[model samples]
Target: MTTGQALVAVRDGTFLPGPCFMPCVDALLYRFRLVPRSILVMGPVGAPLLPP
Candidate 1:
């Protein structure tokens, strides 16, 4: 999926269900106009690190 599609998936709450509550994804997935490799993490602004 691309960013827009991913956004829609998220809005529809159909992205995924997980034990982690949220998903950990690659940083590159959100790059504009790029094909999505994973879900984009958004929240807790200024987080020092992303999931490994």
Candidate 2:
């Protein structure tokens, strides 16, 4: 994939149970048209990952 534009992963809100909080993520899937130059998590911005 080629670099087209900057993209950020976002979610509307955290998960919740029937009557309580239950934060969770079904999965961490990165679906993009172009290859991202960098992917950031809890660490520094613009962190690099393995080349495709």
Candidate 3:
């Protein structure tokens, strides 16, 4: 998802945005140790991401 989309997601959720580290850790867990085993790095929170 795009950064905008992620922002929306985080906003929609009960929690407010904090540090990027938390999401990075979550992504890592799903990347190598969880079901589906997939992760997408969306240019860090509050940063710019060029459309591909």
Clashing pairs in 2: none
- What are the per-residue Cα lDDT tens digits for candidate 2 across 1-52? 2232222112113222311331122112224323232432322332234232
Per-residue alpha-carbon lDDT of model 3 for 4-46, expressed as tens digits?
Answer: 9989887657344434556676677777766443334443543
Give the number of the best model, judged by lDDT.
3
Q: Give model 2 RMSD, 1 decimal.
A: 15.6
Q: lDDT order of candidates, best first?
A: 3, 1, 2
Clashes of each: 0, 0, 0
Model 2 Cα shift for residue 32 (angstroms):
2.0
Off by over 4 Å in 1: 14-52
Instruction: Please report, in order, the local distance difference test score of every candidate based on alpha carbons.
Output: 0.47, 0.26, 0.57
Task: Report lDDT (Cα) of residue 12, candidate 1.
Answer: 57
lDDT for 29 in candidate 1 is: 41
For model 1 the local lDDT of residue 27 reads 33
Candidate 3 minimal-lDDT segment of 10 residues: 37-46
Candidate 3 segments whose C-alpha is farther than 4 A from its true place? 1-18, 35-52
Candidate 1 displacement at residue 15 in angstroms: 12
